[model samples]
Every structure is written in C-alpha cells, then in structure tokens.
Target: MTDQPVTYSADSRLASIWSAAAASWLPPITLILAIVVAWEAAVRIFSISSFIIPAPTEVAKSLVAQWDTLMQATLVTAGEILFGFVVSVVVGIAIALIIVRFDWLGRALYPLVVLFQNVPKVALAPIFILWFGYGLAPKIGLILVIAFFPVTLSMLAGMKSVDHSLLLLMNSVGASRTQILFRILVPHSLPSLMAGTKIAATLSVIGAIVGEFAGASDGLGYIIQFASTQLDTALVFAALLLVSVLGVAFYYAAEILERIVVPWRPKFNDA
Candidate 1:
C-alpha cells in the first residue's frame, strides 16, 4: 500500500499560525504598552511636576510642537552617525583583513588597537576637538573611534574562525588564499559582522552626542545641553526622547538588515 502524506486539519493550521504570530511579537509589544501605562500612572499618582518628569502626554505634545526643530537636529545627528559609521566599517574591515592576513602586522599593531580602545573616549574628546577643530570633523572622528573597535574585533574573530577543515580542503584543491577568504571565510563571518554592526549602530549615536556635548553648537546634544542649563527639563526630556527613538529605530533597522542578510536563521517554532 502507498503511504499517504498526513495533512494537518484547518483548525490546527489556524492555531499554529496564531501561535507563531504571538511568539514573534507578543512579548515586546506587551512590554512597551505596559511601560507606557505604568509611566502615565506614576506621574498622575504621585502628582509629579512636568519639570521633574514630564508625563508621556506632555512629551507627546512637546514632540508635536517642536517637531520641526527636533527633526532638523535629528537629521543632523543621523547624518553624522551614518557618515561616521560607514567610515568606521570600511576602515575597520580593512584593518581586520590586514591583521588576519599577516601575522606580523597583527602582532605589531593589534596592541595599539587595545591601547586605543582602553582609553576613555570622553577623555579624548578635548584632544579630538583640538585636532579636528569642532564643526563636523570632531563628531565624525569621535563616532569612528567608538564604532571602530567592535567592527575590528568582530571581523578579526570571524575571519580567523573559518573552519580548519575547509581551509585544508581549499589547500588540497590548490585554492588561493584570496579565493578561500572570499568564498568561505567572509560568508561564515557575516553573522559576526552583523553583530558588530548592530553594536556600532548604538555606539555611533553616543559618540556623536558626546562630541556635540564637547564642542558642536548644533545637533540634539547641543539642544540637550542648552535645555539642561536653563532648567528646561521638559526640553531635555524631549531631546532625550528623540535620541531614544533614534537609537531604537537605527538598531531595529540594523536588525532587519541582519535578518535579510542571514535568512538561514531559524524562525519561531509553532509546533
């Protein structure tokens, strides 16, 4: 007798679909809603002044009212972060490649990387300002320094972690180092690279803001600084809210890109 494939019933299919959807989105959505509700309740229950901690409603109104200026600052900050991040990625990957390919280079230069990474970036802000002379350059340089390490370390580790078996096989087949690196090492390392990129995405914002705090006369950080000095806590909170939204948006954007790039990652299981 021929074996017939067993098919799930329609009810089972519906249940599985709903379960998958819930597993994918329920946790984060619930947590966000809960936090918003709790925040609103706390401000009301304690009779907290807006200056102390603006209500979510107040923040929302401020967001709408200051959308134009806030948005302009956001765009400027985004531009610096994006430009600096891209520069870091390119330079970091190139450095990683050089180190991985040449043991002497790694031994000679990797320690310097460690030294640089160890230095508190904020401490270097004044030096950077002196060197780059305010404007966009200092911010760009700061962001690059902040973002570069993750990419470098992650790429180096990823490149070096290529399977020994694969390398041996390539050697036996007389595959050139370049071919092996391009065909095997890079593909294997993409996940790690993506992880570094995700980290760099967040750090980039911090670096830009810090740089602004040190020198720049524009950007959200400048707004934050000015607001704080004037005791405009609502405006500070408004700028902070903008920064938070930017970080979330940028991180999730990187996450979406990672998923697209790494489609082999397993999805939620509904069974």
Candidate 2:
C-alpha cells in the first residue's frame, strides 16, 4: 500500500506525456489518413488514368520500387540543401552584422541587397550553370542566392529593433564593440534570426530541388523531371512527396535547434 501512490504518480506522468504527444500529433496524422482515403476513393470512382493522376497506392508502389534510386537522390539533394543552408546562414549573418555596424554603409547598400532578391532565381540558374558547370557548385550557388535573403533581412530587422537606450548604457560602460555585439545585440536578435533560419531552411530545400529541376544529372528534382517526360506520374508524385518530407524535416530541424539556442521561448498547450 505504501508504494501504490508512487506507482500511481508515475503512471499518471506517463499518461500525461502520451496525452500531450497525441494532442500534438493526432490531428495531422488523422487528416493525412483522411485525405489519402478520399484520394483513393476519388480515383477509383472516376477511373482516373494513373498517368493523369496517380492513385496514392500507385505512388506508394513507385516509392517502394524505386527506393534505392530515390534514396541515393535524396542523399544528394540533402547534401546540396545542407551546404547551401549553412553557408547562407553564415554569409547572411555576417552581411547583416556588417550593415548593422556601419550605419552609413547600411543606408547606402541595404536597398541594393533588397533589389538583388527581386531578380528571378530561375533566370539566374542558367547563368550559374554556365559559370559553375553541372556539378553541385551551380546548385549550391543558386541555393545560396535564393535562401540568403530572408536571413539577412530578418537579422537586420532584429538588430535594428533593439532598444536604443540599452545601446547607450552599453556604450557608457566602456563595452567594446565586439562585447556589445555578441553580448547584447546577438542575444537580442536571436529570435528574429531563428525565424529567418526556418524560412531559409525551407528555401534551401526548394532552391536545391528547383535547381535540379532546371538541370541536374542527379537528385530528386532530376528524377521528377525525367519521370514527367516519360509520363510516369507515379514516380513524379513519389519524388514530390519526398521533397515535401525533406522541406518539412528541414523546417522542424530549425524549430528544434531554436529551442536549444533559445530555451526561454515558451510552448503553448496543445490542449
């Protein structure tokens, strides 16, 4: 009898954890299953040709049959995405810092930075291919351009949003510029930077895939393009599903990393 309360408490804790997890995950899982069922029913009812629109089962079969090729392509695409994302974050943060530190430079150059982003990335891909060849170089180059804008823009906003009064206090304390930057500015801007990372993460995935679509010897995008030409819509759908999963994975990775970096951020109750 003495140990019963402790056992009950442990059981209650386990139950609460499962409840929280289900509350978070169950709706999306249920929704996806519902959509899959509806999709299957619609295809059957209409007798839709697989080439016109693959049934979910057809896509599943394609996924299984092409798993080896798909896995290799996924790895190639993941490398491109990760390389571009890391570089973009570093380059974007550096550029934002430089612009922030040099007030006159920021005024003169920030508009140009914004202007560069307006140029269509698709248009630039060919030029990058010409310059960098058909290797990962061209893909990474394009991804960098496509993904860096949001990080730089968001970081600038966060740094600029810091309280002016706090800057004055730091200035009065004989704090070095480096000290001010890392200790005050960086910390203050972290949340905004993290928000940018999420955007950049997804963009990295998009840019790599799109780059491949434009022209690549490998990667999921290449598979998608080839499948389309052959009218293998099932394979195309499988590739698209893989790309979606990759994007979602990258986005959630950023979200999880943000938690580690900014543990103070609050979590809302799923209930």
Candidate 3:
C-alpha cells in the first residue's frame, strides 16, 4: 500500500536544467533587445544627429568598420587589466595574510591602507605617469593601486570573522598556527575573497582607462579621447561598448573561477 517513488529520467532532468537556464537568461536578453530596438527607433524618429547620439545600428556599423583598431586598443587595455589584477591578487592576499598573522602589523598598516584608498585615485594617475612614463607600467601600477584595497580588506574581514569557537576547537586539538590558517581561515575567507575579486576586476578596467586618459598612446580610453576630438560619437560609443563588454567579461570570468574554486558555496545571485 506504499506509494511509488517518483524518478526523473536523464533526458527529463537535462530538459529541466536547460529550462531553468533559459528562464534565468531570457528576461535579460529580451530586455536588452528591446532597449536596442527602442534606441534605434528614437534616433530615427527624432532625426537625431549621429554626432550627438549614435543609433544602435550606427554603433554596430562603426564597431565592424573599426574592428581592427578597436580590437588592438581593447587588447592593450585588457593586458593592463590582466596584469594589474594578478599583481593585486597576489600582493593583496599576501598583505592580508601578514595583517592577520601579525596584530601589530595590521594595526600599524590598516589605517594607512584606508587613508591611501581615500586619496583620489585620478590624482595619482598623473603622478604614476610622471614616475613610470607613458607606458604600460604606469597603467598596470594604477590598476594595482586601484584594485588592491578591496581584496585586502575583504580577506582581512573574512579572516577576522572566523568563529572563535572553531578556533578554540582547533586549539584544543593542538593545531599549529599554520595548519589553522590553511585549514580554516583560508577556506572561510574564500567567499569574501571572490567578492573582492569581482569588484577588483571591474575597478581594474577603470584604472587602466584612467591611466590611458592621463597618458597613453593606445587602449580604449585613448581611442575614446581621440574620437572625441573628431566628434566621432559613433566611434566613441563603439569603443565604450567594447569597454563595457570587457568589464562584464572580466566579472563573469571571476564568477566562474569562484564557482570552480568554491563549489560548496551557492552562486552569487543565489546568495
């Protein structure tokens, strides 16, 4: 008289998974398409000058026409962002570890870190260019400076947030400081680290652009600046679109890495 248990077939399970994925992606895609359509329509209906605001079609055409130049600029910017982000991750994590391991160091340095972060990053760009010259070094330096704070702060918070009870339990077991740090603190801090990484990724792009704006012969920021002088609004929009795409790509790449590294945690949106 027991009821039979329900079981989903493999095909049905896959179909359900795909259905859920589609449901998640559909709204955003649809909205973007609608916006593009509206934008195109508005420009046409109002006879808006492309110099003022390029239509989506005009932007798309410019993107294709200038693909070579745009791609090279994008690559220059991407390289700066990638290098800067890597340096930030390494240096930030190292600083966080030192801060957590040494109370005196944390007390001595954390305030300075916060104060430096509060300083206008844009102002520093000029100084960096002056010191490092108008080369990739300055751009990478700017990105590192801009991206470093978030990761360090997030890791510090995560390390400090570790449950005292857990620490006591580990201590009772005679766990060494290194073991406790590796086994507990680092694992617990992953979510916060990933969160900071996502922020850093977006900021890295901004820092690169700012550096380029201050002084650069290449990169998307340079392209935008050059186009502005010519009043080539469509090219400006096209370059901007590339920057937006790069930022989104960098963000999602970090998200994917977080998922791979910390599979136990829920996806960011889910949480």
Number of the top candidate by lDDT?
A: 3
lDDT of 1 by residue, 211-250 (tens): 9899877889988998888877778888998898888888
Give one digit per residue, the lDDT tens place, for model 3 in 13-80. Answer: 78877888888999999999999999999999999999999999999999999999999999999998
**Worst ten in a row by lDDT for model 3:** 262-271
TM-score of each: 0.86, 0.91, 0.92
- Of 2 and 3, the candidate ranking higher by lDDT: 3
Off by over 4 Å in 2: 1-18, 268-271
Candidate 2 shows a clash count of 0
Q: How should the candidates be ordered by lDDT, best one leading?
A: 3, 2, 1
Maximum-TM-score candidate: 3
> Residue 47 lDDT in model 2?
99
lDDT of 3 at 13: 73
Candidate 2's residue-wise lDDT over 1-271, tens digit each? 4765333477876788789998889999999999999999999999999999999999999999999999999999999999999999998998898887778997887898889989998788888888888899989888899999999998888887999999899999899888888898888888889999999999999889878977899999999999999999999999999999999999999999998987866554522
Where in model 1 is the C-alpha error above 4 Å? 1-21, 264-271
Q: How big is the RMSD of model 3?
A: 3.7
